[model samples]
Target: MASERAAAAGVLRRPRLVIFDFDGVIADSETIALEELAAEMTARGAETSYEQARALFLGMSTARHMAYISEKSGRPCAPDFPDVWHGRLFSRYSTELVAVTGVHRTLNLLDRLGIDYCIASGGSVERIRFALDCLGLASRFEGRAFSAEMVARGKPAPDLFLHAAAARSTSPHECLVVEDAPSGVMAAVAAEMPCAAFLGGSHLDPIRTRHRETLIQAGATACVGDHAELQVMIEAR
Candidate 1:
């Protein structure tokens, strides 16, 4: 319905800059990452499922994810866990990662409109860059990627989003955040930015309804089912 309205209006409130979350919003890597995490935790004796892993760490940073796993599993994560996990994840990413469907088209729309855009994610900069490279999007986002490691706090806190806006020389209200996780929506809201919750990630296929409701409840101004709808929302004047 909102997509229809945006299409009819021919103009949504265009933002000065668009801030995207890297994993689920730009790259379809969340399912793979979560599946790996689930297996890792299960092997460590946590006995977690992919869904459970998603619910717990979908938008969390590496440190936070490890902490959550340690707490929930009642097992101390080995000091090298992050390194080991990242090694495995990156291996999978190299072979399986791809851009979210329609993302290139959405980016093209933004480029044609003269809108600036950047990425701000809960992932490490190395991982983010690696993913972009795997998806062949590294050049597009070359110097525009921001990671949680760049800020003292990550998602669900305004720090990272605010940092991204500041880095882009855009005011909070002038930025639009595209996110697929509730924590990310909350962070965008906390940063005083308009947020569009993305429901197009493959990881959301089985839990779209609940995820949509959760994102809305967390303060998303809009929920887009795909980058096509997102393009309409961004193109509306």
Candidate 2:
């Protein structure tokens, strides 16, 4: 680690690994997921908008989503909430999910740079795998994708990101996380990892300015709105 003076004096170490958050960063699925969640919540009498749902659960597990809904609505979510929500989600995903715009190009750039990357998401392993496979990204990640379920805690807590870095043979400080949510960015910060906050998700494009500031305030070292900006940051001197 370099002192602030040295860091400002052109001393720095390039990160050894890139950790990606999947739902919003890679799969182009967060908006759709939030839409479906809002619909489900409305149907179950919770009645929230997509915006509200996204704000409430951007970087949480399905269990947490349900808990939040229950607490907010003053009614218990159904015991089958997880199964039903996931069923609808996977159904829509089968027909609607796509890779985030420019993901392939960014990945190709990383490949050319010989930079190894992996997915570490608050999403469940099953959901992560399903979306990656749907987006034709499974082979690229192979054994490297990790889930919140694999760790003791999820985002805004460092456990999942820390576990991912450890499993991938990178120390926390040696990894750079590209995240779409404030919670994920905070988790990276807590893990002592440098963060490159991403804001290209369809759900976020509408609120880029606000989200960008929030991420920076949460300790992102860089904020990139799309893969092009990401490429620039990754290759910058």
Best by lDDT: 1
Residue lDDT tens for model 1, 1-237: 565434433523689999999889899999989888788877766788887889988888988877866887788877777677788899999889988899999999999999999999999988898899899899999889999999998999999999988988999999989999989999998998888888989989999889888988998887789899888778765
Across 111-163, the per-residue lDDT of candidate 2 in tens digits comes to 88888899988887888888888888889999999999998888999998899
lDDT at 211, model 2 = 81
Give the worst 10-residue stretch by lDDT in candidate 1: 3-12
Which pairs of residues collide in model 2?
none
- Clashes per model (N, Cα, C within 3 A): 4, 0
Model 2 — TM-score against the truth? 0.91
lDDT by candidate, in order shown: 0.87, 0.83
Off by over 4 Å in 2: 1-13
Candidate 2 global CA lDDT score: 0.83
